[model samples]
Target: MKKISSNRKKNHLAWTIALVMAAPFACASDVNFSGFLSVGGGMLDDEDAVAYGGYDEEDLTFDRNLLGLQVSGQINEKVTATAQLIARSNNDYEVDAEWAYLSWQANDFVKVRAGRLRTPFYMYSDFLDVGYSYAWITPPQEVYYLPFNNVDGVDVYLTGTLGIFDTSLQAYFGSFTDDLVLSGAPADAETRNQIGLSGTLGKDWWTLRAAYHQADLTIDVTGIPISQTATLGSFVNTLRTFGFNSNADRVLVEEDDVTFAEVGINIDTGRFVAAAEHVEFDPGDAILSKNIREYVMVGVRAGDWLIHLTAAKAKDEATHPETGIPVGQPLPVVGSTNFLIGTLQAIANSQAIERDVLTLGTRWDVTTGTAIKFQIDDIDSPDSVLVDGTVVSGQQKVFSVAVQTVF
Candidate 1:
């Protein structure tokens, strides 16, 4: 079934690419074409460590590489249509539709966009895949690793000058459904009643941004349901019999409200660049715990090269609730349900993380619209799992190199 879906995606992408290639001849001067590409690879020092996004100890898989094409056409004096198709190495070479929208220029200060749009959650969320536009080989994964990326809906944007400061505001309403990795397994997920607002204020050499978004999130946990295993099932049944309904529900995932908030600042003064951002995720009353992530980066430019340092961290905001089951206690029928309880508790605690990473990198512009970058990361994850779910204590080192280009 997965293979079939992949084939369909490929066929659709082929047709889209053909149309885009022929658009210039068909529409004469009304259509424009552009694209971006990134070829990258990385490796970890520890061979036992689960690969980071497909990179292994000594293998360079280019799984992080991607190519994207964007086509836009002017339909009339007040409206335009834009679409972007991207093919990623991680998706088995299947091209996916990243953006397809119709934009309307309502006035000089206001505009509207309707269709599939990028979710405005962070400072760099909109242009995440365009590596040539950013200093890092990739954005901080601790903050950018959210499962949901886009929404299908409409948004209104307002931009103008406020005194000496240039200001912009955007409001959007949308919904999204996608497949996500949950607890090391694939699961179907959906976000309903998704709404968001973001604003930016800038003057001279610095800019400040803030955004808020919320939605009702639901995920199908049938693959690893809480009551499917014999031990877990018996434990949950015992808890319910003992009037621990809240505890049981806390261990199960269901429909709940998820909220995200972010604030960031960016500075650029010709030769110096600095950026810092903080974000929070609140999964209210869900099995998932609340988390906070933040990062600070500073860099200096000399000729065609820019060198930067970054520090980032992710921490859990709440500890797992006590299940109130006594350890080493004997219970009727289920002798030692205590062990099962402890295992469940440990799983919950594993979801909480206290991790930090330090990185140093250099990006050299090789040409007008191309760059080559080299980076080294020192990661310290004492109580957290890596992106691939490999548990690592203390510190580990990873190195990466990439070339990015845009045309």
Candidate 2:
């Protein structure tokens, strides 16, 4: 897929803003327009930490700043149309369509929607980009860095009261295609046969939710199939020369099944708030690793100010090719091939990441619709390596401040 250039993205955003600004005039009635904005700047204590926070050493960048516009119109008594566009500083002020969907209220208990929609992958998936909706300056990155966020398809949602609890259920089917940032580089990625189910139950100030999603995934590494990597390709070819075609195929990166499961709970009273979520990813492929992510946040409100603490972690399980190459297996080239295999195994093992972050933040309500926040994060990733192949050691600190508001 061709990536959109920054210049083109800017032009697209301008055109989109013009169209949205004229929407009310064109519709004349029953059309509503609103927007949200977040302007932020931050710097990392260590230059090597840039990979961890997207911040440069001692340089404040407004990478987190963003603007979103939403337009919704009631098409009839039972139908409505909504569209949202967002421009982000990190993307060079690129505008992107976050959502464009048509919804129908079958009755008070059920609703259906079609077109592009947010994937219900986590507790805050639906409002991931809307910083004003959440107390934290940003969502926990450990669990929120999934490559795909939205899908193109349809969904059915049902909500009602169950005794003293308010309950909701949702099911969706969709496909997604995008250029994703992987290992600090852009990769062409696609997901098909995407299906998911989610449910939530809430009463009073507490809520619980769970979701399950599965899809067939394909990712092009270095603009080529993963099986074509120089290292992997050489290994596979060597096996093939030894009449091990099946073994070679076992190490290939063909279409693979991937699954994601998540569960979360939250307690939100007027003065106190607590939330935690756990998610697991099983990428059933030799080229991809399975991982688990979790986070917990607690906060207390004092007058117009809220203080919060969060801890989050992610662990990637090591994966090995199924080619049955033993540690002492004889190589075609005695010393060189042995070294090659050893290096490859070490690389695979290094992909296993055990990292954690601790954050302290405060949100001050400047007005009913606006908030200002400051946060500091302590990140630890001893086993993880940066894009430049440098191992990250000890702990790094990042400081950030932002103002978020909704119109």
Candidate 3:
């Protein structure tokens, strides 16, 4: 899926519409064009100096205003092609292609797709951008905050029945390049040689899912403030200049291996629904911190309204790499052994994330293909236990409402 990050405004409606209008000509088969929209506004009830989920106390923000258009066509009995375009207010309406791929049906239970594809790192990844398909105003942010979403590659899927259970399996290979925000700094990010495998099993009212994905990642942030005098990258170079090759290598994020593992469960019993997903991100030999994120949700249906409660938590441990240089040991220049150790530790521990959130929400299906939703979110963060941010630890709250429709 695509995101409207930072601030850039554009009128890409014409571009998006042109793609949809030309879908028929691109395929010999009948074309299907569908669209979805989420129009809404949200604001933080307090905490002027800080922001959460694009909401601030200064004013009402429509950052959640999002639009998506999907086009698909059956190329043949065994093949199909799909493309999706998305625009968002936070991105200033600059349109982006969220998905563009061709799929091949090999048999009754096997399928394959290749091209620019959504990364299936999570359970809801296939429809992450489709607001009308899911129950939450948004998926649990903690688990969904993957560094990147789309990759250019291929995936294979298999589905069948196993005794009393239905089963599905997927494996994919791809690479992605994009801009990322790491530790509040903009950086060029790349993930290469990605491989992922996932499986799901369902029996009656419950389903279980598990997945694993891994890649070599590199990040280049310009002029980060981790070092008061130089960027971390530059500091690493300086360490190399002093023949501290081993120390320099330990602090760099060049082609570092990273892995993600997930397990989730979902249950639906006519009037009740429950789901939970847990994920862990591990960065091996990388100075970046590691994270564990998870969320649990439960809801009940009464007439047209589905009321729910969700709790999410994310925690990370700062990586503190040993520099080999002992404290009080002599150094070749103005910096001491302890100074080198401190800088290495500082760079390693710079990226730390910790948050806990509780949410209460209601969704009303006013009519087919449309819905209205309202939600209240309370956030408690160890990082947000601020000193000068003008917000007390217990005062962080946000309220939001949205109307979503698919047509």
Candidate 4:
């Protein structure tokens, strides 16, 4: 696919009109361009500060604004190309090509694509683009926690009917790079190279999938604060450093390797849909957990309103393949098992992952291209918890409202 290199805002009014007029005589193939822009503002219902690592949540900041453009064309009966570009608040005015792949149809039952492509590791990977999909916003964060967005590689897809069954299989091998290690310690210059496979089976309203991923990790050290006068001061300095510094400072990743596996299913009737997934990760000598992550969600649509409920949980522990050491050791610190100590333990146990969350939200389609969303989230942490800029012993709650639209 040709990369969408232009960032200029363009008008396609004349082209659209001509295409519509020529539709009758056009072949089965065509070129289509579509995109969406979503701008929204939201706030945390409570004004109090909630601290996670060392810093309090930025007080009710502007919700992220996102834009995406997609262009696709069928070159002939057996060839096609697709390209997508996305812009987000985190990158300010910068826009990047998110997906650009060339596909070849080998037969009625098989097709192949290679290039920079979306990794089909999760349920929504294929249709994450904003232009032609419906959703008040993005999927929940807990269910879609992949660190790297895309991989440079190849995909083989098989889709056809076998007897009474419809089947799909996708297998791919690819490598990815990101500043933060995908499943291990946060090395300053972290890298991961991965290979993965996913398959699906479905007929009518039911579908199922299983995916597996394995990667080699590499870490490098570039720049970071060496020391601080006090513990709190040191922690605060680290947070501020990461927040303010661009990619100038560097750190080396001492140990490297990660493995992940996931399986999921989806069922949809006219009025309701249900989905669930289970994922697991092994830290492989980095500062993260070797644990299992899982979640389930259900949604119902009635007229112009849609309601969704989600529950998720994660369990952290020592890498099971390792031999006879105690499962894991508690982080050392003064004053019982405190928040700071717990967070460190959670980090060091390179495997201490225990968290559960429940979220309830409703989306109202106010118009063709706009929607309003309100959600209530309840969080549970039996281990010491980080509270409003302070350490607390247990559960937490948060509420948010978002107005999302496309133009």
Candidate 5:
């Protein structure tokens, strides 16, 4: 099976890397370590919009503290090994050997590296360090949608010249595991085994990158909730009165298959740096409704200020996929439109769906590595209106401000 094969490949990659690391090496000099923390306070226009209230409308948190220690020293003049430990919010950490292995500068026309490393999935992925990167406020959530974007793997990079233009070729193989919670269900883990190829070509002020990737993912959702449960006490009472003894269990689980692919571009000319990305994800039968998610965003920097404008929309057609009713058309009902009755009808008449989002924001660097950001978003939905003999309108606006920095 494809899944079996992918799993095997990942296991093999891990074993191979472990063996390479185990082969004792010559003693290297001093190791290096550094880290930073970004504590922020923010306010949201409406707290109800958040799926969970881990963050407050106004509170300070070390949600962005990153502790990293790297060890790197040269083997001869051309070979090196580097490893890092990335810490999380709960004071826990993971070994992120961002770059480990041997590099051979074969010649003026070719170069190669082998070991565990990072694949250039996005512009910022290569520099996810909190202390070094700009942004006290996290990057826009619309585009930075992927919860975890790294792979434990091996990579090969080739660099050369094509007349007046320069080029680089990169290929990689690896696997990654991380939890994703799209709906109100318990988190599920997505394990990915993948391989990809990317290339960059350009002259001076301009360069472009194109990449193709294929990943096999298995989603484990055993503890996640499937459908809404009615009142527990009511169900238990009815069962007891009927002289039935049953261990009423209410839990749902569904496995999922996923595949993701993306392409993006970046450009910088003296006083300005511009970038944009477009990505798509297919969560086949994963959580509940979302079968596909797609979005794109563009941003620019000028002076000490960064102005970013983004628009993104996601539609989960499966939210109310089946209402246990025959599908054809609306049922005609004569009488005053009752809010409760209409709401029930809407639930029964058609599957509930939503599409809405518009975002705009700006950030200014007030100091060397600290900045302030303000953002506003407007939400709209067509089906939000109730059938009250007339259309009932509903809309909400969200505004937020925060300070971010790394030390």
Candidate 6:
């Protein structure tokens, strides 16, 4: 959902490193090792086009290069520890832990996990970082938009059968703090009181998934003061100072409630496949618009070769509040009250999402655990988006190829 900034701290105590450093003390036979790697490159073909998935017309780069290693060790009869350490080329090869947790098998049908875990907000959340786990070189950004992928938390998972459907349920609560890419800028951000619930039912070649997640989000992007408070906050404070409290309440983002909801259906037979998902995001009282995104895909497989086509789109709904301030009324030293209100409105409108992308791709299995893929994506954004008050082209055509292997 978000790109990590390059200036992240490097000396933090990551659970992946902690677990791996302690691996030597455990019995060598108790620990198992597995890994995956992907090396990819792509280029955009048009001038004045926005970048997609980090590919641009300026230069062809291997930002898609990534390698990850996983280790699991049995701690006891009922407990086990697992960790995954990943190095991404885009992050300057800095190792990060996508998963590090201890699982306790309470019974045949129930399990508990604690420590760092993936946020189960999407159908592919568990393997979101693993390119080999999915058919597309990259999942649709419209639907796969979220910045926090992992959380420090605990979760309970239960599995059972309901008549003809195999059912699994997951419930979790956690917190996440890191640098977030908001409005194309890196900012210090945090999410708290984050809770999520997801369930899946499957039988035969058909599967169904639904999930809901909500959290209190805060992004610190401080700047010039419109008054005594910060830029964003001064608007609310000024509104309150002028006794227009209702308007102020509509645009406050400090610890505001944000939610995500999604539903997905998939069907697959040996030679044919189809899948679709719909997702919505609501940021309560924030200066960002509500967003809805969806995608549909169909594919066919013949022998070791497969072809697929995908269509994805995203739309935004504005939640801008009419501050009721008179327009263009001049003030002393500071613009007009309308300028303050218009700034807030522009902030909301700037984040409006309007994107549609059509993708044609193919995959070939070169060996038992290795595959090669090529894809072309035609993106069309009928409506332009604003970034830092600047308008730019949103259409880009990208061509890419990748080699993925799991060992």
Summarize candidate 1's per-residue lDDT along 293-407 as a digit string, tens digits: 9999999999999999999898876535445656776766657656547656665666666678898999999999999999888878764466466675456778899999999
Q: Which residue pairs of candidate 6 clash?
A: 1-146
Residue 247 in model 4: lDDT? 12
Computed on alpha carbons, the lDDT of every model, listed in order, comes to 0.77, 0.77, 0.78, 0.59, 0.49, 0.79
TM-score of each: 0.87, 0.87, 0.89, 0.72, 0.63, 0.89
* lDDT score at residue 369, model 4, on the 0-100 scale: 79
- Report the C-alpha lDDT of model 6 over 104-149, residue by residue, as the tens digit: 9999899999877889877778987677767788778788887778
Q: Candidate 4 residues 280-307, lDDT tens each?
A: 7776665445667888889998998889
Model 5 residue 11 CA deviation in Å:
14
Task: Please report, as a residue range, the 10-residue window in candidate 5 with the lowest summed lDDT.
Answer: 245-254
**Residue 385: error of model 3 in Å?**
8.6
Better of 4 and 6 by TM-score: 6
In the range 80-140, model 5's lDDT, one tens digit per residue, is: 5555445444333433443455556666655566665565665455655552364314543
Candidate 2 achieves a global lDDT of: 0.77
**Candidate 5: residue 24 Cα off by (Å):** 8.2
Report the alpha-carbon TM-score of model 2 versus the true structure. Answer: 0.87
| Residue 25 in model 4: lDDT | 26
Looking at candidate 1, the ten consecutive residues that score lowest on lDDT are 1-10
Off by over 4 Å in 4: 1-29, 46-60, 129-136, 181-193, 221-255, 318-347, 368-370, 382-395, 403-407
Q: For model 3, what is the error of residue 348's alpha carbon versus the real structure, in angstroms, after optimal superposition?
A: 3.1
Better of 5 and 6 by lDDT: 6
